[model samples]
Structure formats: structure tokens, C-alpha cells
Target: MTSLWHRRRQPDDVPTPVAVAVSDFCRRAKAAATPTEVREALALLADEDDFRVRSLTDTEPERSPLGPFAVVDILRGTAPELASQRQGCGYYEVVRELARVREEKAPPAPAPTGLTFAAPPAAPSPSSETPPEGSTARAGKSARQAAETLQSRIAPRRREPLAETEPYEAEESVSFKRALPKPRGRFTQVAAPKASYQTLLHVEGKGILESALAQNEHRFALLKSLSEQYNGAKGELGLPDLEGALQRHELMDRLTSRERQGLLAAYTEQRGAAGRVAWSLGLSPSELQRLVSMLQLQAEVEGVRERFQREALGTRHLTQRLDLLGRDKYLADLGIKKRFTEMLRKEMEDLARGELPDAVDLPGLCLAIARKHGAPQELVLRALERLGLSEGLRKQLLAHSNHSSP
Candidate 1:
């Protein structure tokens, strides 16, 4: 692996002129001394706490050491060239010896691990290096013990284990749940190429999503990911359940523009109350506004409604409907695409206008959804009362309409 030493610096460290001068002088005057010693001695004079007041009248003003250290500080600390430098040992061999000896008592390896020492650090022979004097070696330890201690500390990677782990309460109780059966089909019905015809349709209230598009894109993506988490087999309900997983589906979308407007209209005009509308009609809001904007143009209201329903319905009812139809029924209807909310609304309005027979209206189906969802007919009464149509209208609607409006 390449060392970090070669990596380019994020920012170049610029050296001060003072550092350059001190370093240059130290190098020339004390050619044999380590950078640390020269640095310290120079610093002593350069610092505010200087002990020496040396004048560089001779060939080497830095020969004494104090003058160079202050300059060295600015050099090493700031210089881009010295950014990767490690600490270098100088004349302070005493502290070095103590540090090294402290580590020697750590542990010994069974094998030499190809370790080789340059020489006995205690008995310094030659070379320019003058290792610091450590504490006196004990006279009692044999050469074997000395070798073992020395061998223990130098090897890298291998760490000395301090203690072994033992079992606490040996007998622990455990429980296990049986695996769920695999889904009868492949991982997802979505894999069926014929399952959906996902095409975008233009509608009226497109501006409803203008500001929220980017944010809702992220939320929708998360919701899509939520749709992917599967475990075991199909449950008793037979629907793919992200809700059961209970992963936080915190990304509730704000009401779409058309939903807000329609809900507001429904509240203020139809129900004679105003606050928040259905709040769930994001798709409806989009369709409503887009229809108003494009209503005069070539855009068909159903197209926009289809778009809204596709996004708004979000496959809950579609999936269940598809599942009910099974492979055979699905193939016949070209895979059972759902109708848009606007279309359904138009149908309901036609029924109310006496244009369609009761058999063709949602009275039957609404009742079914009503009973299944435990809906309140209170909303129909609420709508009629707000419209101030006949008090008879209120009572009839309350008797007939289901609670499942949203």
C-alpha cells in the first residue's frame, strides 16, 4: 500500500522567513546534531523565555542552539515540504530509554518471527547516534530474559492478549420462530411484464407538484424501496406488507394543489365548513388544476384523471383487484388497469343527475366498500346540509352514501 506520505496536501504549509534562516544556520553550525537538538537550542534563544543571549559574531551564531529553535518552529510547523515528517530523536536518549524499557515487559512470542536487532541498545558501540541513558539494568536478569523481553515489544500486528474470555451464566434460554413459507410466485408480481402499462398522462393541476416535485421524488423513491422489503411467504391477507415491517414511512406528502382546492371547495361550498380538506387528494388536486388550465385546450379530462389515479391510487387497490382476478382473468383484461378518480367522480355525478340508471351507479359498490371500511354516511348528510338542498337530500344521502369518500 502507498503511504500517506505521498498524498498531496489539502493545503500547502508555507514556511516563514524566520524558520528558513534558523534552520539554515543550525544545519551549518551543528552539522552532527539532530534536528531536534538544533531546534530546541535555537528555540531557547528565539523564544520569549530565552536563557541564552548569544550574538552570532562568529562563523556560527546558531552554534549554541537557542537562536535556531524559534525559526525551526515556523519552518517545521508551516512548511509544505515537511508536512509528512515524523518526530526525530535527538540527544534526549534518557527519555527514549525509559519509553523503550517500559514496553519491554509486555510479552514474548513463541517464534522469533524473523525479528533482528541492530545491536544491544544499552551497550552503544559506534555511529553518530548517542542514545539516551536508560535506568540501570538489573544485575539479576539472565541474557535469555533480556532477549525475550526485547523480542516481545518489537514485532508489529501481533498484540498481547491480556486475559481470556469465559462463559458467564452457562445455561441461557433461547427461542426461535419458524420461517415463513416462500411466496407462491417469484419475488414480485411486478416482475410480470404484462402487469402494468405505466405511461404519464398530462392533466390540469400540474403546477401543484412544481414546488414539491423534487422533495416528493425522494419520498416516492423511499416508498418504492419500502415496497421491496419481503420476508417469508404471503400472509393471510395476501398483500405485500411494508406496513407490517413498520419501517418508518414518515414521508407523508403534503396535499396536492387540486386536492387542497377541491377539499377547500368541498368544505366551504358543499359542507359549509372550512379547514383542511380531504388532505389525501394530491392526485385529485393535480388533475383539477390541470383541467382548469388545459380545459379549454385539447387535453381530455379523463387523461388527466387517469394520471392522477395512477399516482394517487398507488397500487393498493390495483394489487388486490389484480390478485382477485388471478392469472386467467388478468390476461383477458390486458392486465386489469384501474380507472381514474375523476372518471369515477364523473360517473357518480351522472348518476346523481339522473343520466344513468341506479344499476350502473356506485350505490352497490359504494355500499360494499362502505361496509368493508366501516364508513360513515355522516359525510353525505354533511355535504347535503352544507349545500342546503332539501333536508330530504341530507337524510336520503345519509341513508344511502357510504363513509368511504376519500
Candidate 2:
């Protein structure tokens, strides 16, 4: 009797159910001769619902071998790896061999029209005469080559069945063909022209600056005229600069003493209206009203002047500032303060270039920004709301974010 350590069980000749099903799926996929047939096969094997087949087909068109290979890869966990071993063969050859192997393993059907396939020819020895290109010897060589390719897709070791009837108990033997390399000719994005971004910033900056500068010039002139008029009127009327004199504490003390002795009058006591006050001061009402107007106009000039300064800020400087602000907000939402200005600039360009479509991926845009800056999920959701995103899109993005969360 064999020693326990040296004892080994024999491999099962029968194929497992998994092997049969996988082989069947591959054969069906290969046999699909027309576009309609291919589609039907895809509908059957490729997932149709929530559990989608994550295949190359998602990226590559169904017309290409890459798509079918992707479908096969999903069906058999090791199919892509096994197929990768066929370094010398084309994708179509690998698929053809898979179908041939399946047909060989299947039970034979009854002969139609009372005809049957002939017996295979004998192998030619080296001493024999060379066979013609279309001869049986050449055909046999082709079949042998196909078998070799098929062998590459099988498990390396012989596996014993878990039970007498369960052929694949040890290893999954029914893996499909190798995964194909990505197909060529898929549409690729053409990079946007670099000048376009610069031009956009330039145009926007120029428009804002021109408007601010125009307003600033107009306001500055108005302020100058008001100042000159107010000065001339004060001198002509011989009015004490009342606002300036009142700034001293000693002036208020003297005024209080004069009021106690009834030697001076208070402006506050003559508050019937501006017209009456002008008459009391022995001044034209229009001149007094112009002084009041000049003071009010001075307040607005300062604010408008500041607006001109801000508008005159450089485009590149403004862009960088805005980009930094977004980055800082995103980072702070995650309680971080690290610098990532370069990455934020790239993300900003992506948005400005319309890389993130508003209708389809508004939420994705927000989440991408948040993710790049390590923002919290709550922050991303709040950002979407702030953008005035539609309810349906918000929900979709929320679900996507939740699903993508660690």
C-alpha cells in the first residue's frame, strides 16, 4: 500500500457544473455572428440591473473582442489571468479555441441528413512528404495549435473531485478565455487650448476694471467740485467752521457757560427745518443745503474709490485668491489647514473649462472638490445645497458619496 504522505487521488475526467456553465457562456458569446445575436448574448450574460458586470465593455464598444473578454472575465474569476498567459496568440484565436474546446467537451448531436464528420487524419512524420497548404495535415496542425492555446487557460495542476459526481471540487476548471488588452480607437478627450483659459481670465478682468475705473473717475470729479464749492461758500458767508470748532472740549464748555448766562443761542433750539435754520443764520437756504449735500457725497466717494482699487487687482491675483479661498474652505471643513494650492488650481480649471457638466455631475463636482481637499461628507452635501442643485441630483450625489465612503 502507498504511504499516507505519498498517497494521491486521481483527477476527475468529468467537467464540473461551473465549468459547463462558463464554457457554455463563452461558446455562446463566440458563436454570436451578428450584432443582434451579440446583443442578445450580452443581455443574457452581462448583468442587466443593479449588479452590473464591471467589464471592458463598459469602456470599450461591444463590437470589439475586449468587450467580450471583459464579460468572460467577470464570469470566471481567474479567466483574465489565464488568458493573459497566451502571450503569442491574438484575442480572436483565443476566443475561437474556447468555443472549439466547449464543442469538443459537449455530447455529440445526432447526424442531420444522415451525414457525420470524418475521422481525423494521421499525424505526418518528418520523413513524409510535405502536405499542401489546405491538406488534412495542415488542418490537424491548426487544431493542435488551438488545443495548446486552450490548455493555457486551464488550471496547472490536476485536481481531484470533492465527490465522485462533483468534478470541480478541487479547482474551478471551467474558466473562460484570457482578458484582452484594451481596444484601440476609443474616443479620447482633446485637451482644451491653454490660451483659452488665459483669454477668459483676461476678458473678465478687463470688463470689471474698466467699469470700476469709469465710476471712480466720475465720483472723484464730483467730490472735487463739491469740495471747492463748499470752501468758497464758507469764505463768502463768513461762517465759522462750526464742525471743526466743535471738535474741541473747550468750545463745548464755553458754549455751556454762555447758554447759562443767556448770552448765546443754541442751533439745536432752532430745529424747525433747514429753511428756518438758514434764515436764523442769515444764510441762503440753497448754500446751506449744498454744504449738507457735499458731506453726504464725500461718504460715497470713499467707498467707490475702494471699489476701484479692488477692481484694479490683477486677474491672475484674483484667480489665485478665489482658488485659495475654495481650497481653504474645503480643507477647513475637514479641520485641516495644510497648503494644496496647486491641486486646487487644477480643480478650479476643470470647473471653469466645463469638465464637470452641470446637468449630470454637479454633485460629482462638489464631492470631487471635497474629496481632493479631504472634506467631510456633510460639508460636500452642504456645498451642493449652496450651489442650488436640483433635489434629484442632490440625492444621487449623496447616494454616490455614501457608497464611495470608506
Candidate 3:
């Protein structure tokens, strides 16, 4: 009876008893993945000793190596280990293989497309200036001192936006309007070539120093060489021949993309800044900017005047012609508008520079200045009214006019 029972249980057909049990477990696991997929994975337990046999979930490091377990116990279904692995990254290959072994009855998957991507470039690291070598090591937080040192050196009047070389605190707000110091000579500055060369060498290291000086000198020399260039081209458009255009192009192309932008920005800033300096010394950028504009306007006016005379047009007609060239509804209005715009740009520059524009139309200029300075427009108007400043006197007020006490 025992031999008959053994034969009934051990019929030799498809699967062995052990394999059948495993396949059955896998089939049941496929329903909801018997928590064994999370079990330390085959890859985690994969080893070199292929001939060495071992049961699944056995910690046979000499044979399979590593853990034969995942976060949770398969039979119990609790994963305390995975909670500790939150910081680890994923490896989808192991997860896919596990799923495949468990769900064999499912249809085959489509071939995958291969994709490759490069990592992005890293940001520039902060420049660390090691303070004089053997001196007592400075506190890490002393970056404020370095920032103050830098501010005292080059950035105040250059009107540069401040950024630090190291970690630093935010700059506290201060009144932008301050009284101008007593004027010396021309508000315009003429940087001595030799002195400028020295300044460049001192500020920038040897690499850019000579190059920057050479670039500046080249521009200056180009202007000198093409003395007749600004006279307007002789070929109908009044444009100059620009004989040194090649030199300018070469100089510009030699600069890096960033350097070119910085150079142009600096020049524009300097142009506006010089005008403001002139304003602080009792002149206006409007007059300077307008001088160039008016020079062209003068020729246009003269030509139109001749045309009007030859055609026997009325005075109103000539004035209208000027207005048309200037693009104003009325000639007189055009003049006024040009003057106002010129003055506004001038005053705007002044608000940025150390001084303010003189009080012309106190309320109007004040509002313009206020807008430039990011202050309330009505506040400036109200202040002007309270001060009882005459139109002419108001015109005398500098951009500093906003600061009541100062």
C-alpha cells in the first residue's frame, strides 16, 4: 500500500515536485506579485559559482553572494528595509527581470528604443581668494569685509550692479539722492592714455590689460585717421566712407561674446554717465544729446526754408514742413517735445548718476525724475508745490531735489 501511494504521488511526467511548487507559487504571485519581486532581486544575489546550487531566499554568500532578500518578507508582506533606502537611486533592469519571471503567461513586449543623453555642464565655481598665507585664518563669514573692500575699489561711480565673489549679506538701502560735491572743472572727463594704461594693468591681469588698452587706442586712432568720416558719406546718403571699418570689425570680433556685450553696455553707460556728470556741474545731458540732433535738424530746416522760398509757400507752410520732418503735429510743438524728451533722458541719466537735473518744469521734471528713481510721481509733484519753487528756480534744482533735508 505504501509503494502504491509513493508511485501515485511521484508520477514522472512534466515537472518535478519542487519545480511544480515553484511554478505554482510564481503563478499565484503573478496575480499581485507575491511581495517576492521586492525581494533582494536576482541581480543582487547573482554570483560567479554557477555550479553551486542553492535555494531561493538563502543567504549563501559563498555561492550567490549579497542579500537574498528585499525590503519585505515574502510570506509576511512588511517592508521596513525600503524605508531606509529612500536616498538610493533606481535600477529598472532588476525590477523588469523579476516581473518577467513571475508573469510568464503574459504576451511578449515590444522592442525598446535606445536613447542617449549627455549631462549638462556644471556652473562656474565661486572664485576663492586665499587671504595672505600664514596670517591667522580669517573667519569664514568675513566675506562682508571682502565685499566692502571691493565696493571701495572700483564699483561706486562706475554704477555697476553689485555681485560678490563670495557669500555675503544683502546690501542695505540708502537714499539715492545725495547732494553733489562742489564742481571742479569740466564735467567731462579725459582719461590720460598713460594713466588709463596703468589703471587697466592694475585692475585687470596681464592678459586683458594690454588687449583692452590696444582696443581703446585703436578706436581712438581710427577716429583720428578717418577725420573726414563723420562729415557724412559723400555718396548721397551723407554716410562716411568708414575706411577703418575693417579695423573696428577685427577688434570687435576678437572679443568674447560676453566681453563684447559688456564693452558695449559699458560704453552706453559711460555715455549716459558723462552726461550726468555734466548735469551735476550745472549742465544737462539734453543739451549735449540735442546738440548732435540739432546739428542735423539745422541742415534740414535750412533746406526746407529754401524750398518754401522758391515755391512761394506761406510761413505756416514752412513751419508745417519742419514739423513733418521732425514728426510732430505742429512745428512749435515739435520743438517743445524734443526739448522735453531730451531733458527727460538727461534727467533720467542724472537720477542714476550722482546729481539730479535742474528744475525746469518742476512738476514735470520731478515726475520724470521720480519715475526714474522709482519713487511716487505724485510725491515729487506735491513736494515741488510745497517748496514754492519758481519755474525758473525749479529748473535750477538738481536731481537731488527729491531729498528734502539733503
* Per-residue accuracy of model 1 over 1-406 as CA lDDT, tens digit each: 1121111111112222333344455454333333333333333222432212222322343212222332333233433112112122232233233333443554554764576544354454476365444423442244456777666667655533223222212325455978887676656445422211111012321332233344432222323432333222342211123222221222123323433344344433322211112233333444434433532322433343344335433444432322222222222222223343333334334334452123223344334333443443222222223334334433455554454344
The candidate scoring highest on lDDT is 2
Q: Write the per-residue lDDT of candidate 2 for residues 170-201, one digit (tens) a residue.
A: 33456589986765565554544322212212
Q: Give the local distance difference test score of model 3.
A: 0.34
Worst 10 residues of 2 by lDDT: 1-10
- The parts of candidate 1 lying over 4 Å away from their true place are 1-112, 115-137, 140-146, 159-306, 310-406
Please list the C-alpha lDDT of all candidates, in the order they appear. Answer: 0.33, 0.38, 0.34
Worst 10 residues of 3 by lDDT: 1-10
In every candidate, how many clashes are there? Answer: 19, 1, 13
Which runs in model 3 stand beyond 4 Å of their true positions? 1-218, 221-252, 255-263, 267-406
The better-scoring model by lDDT among 1 and 2 is 2
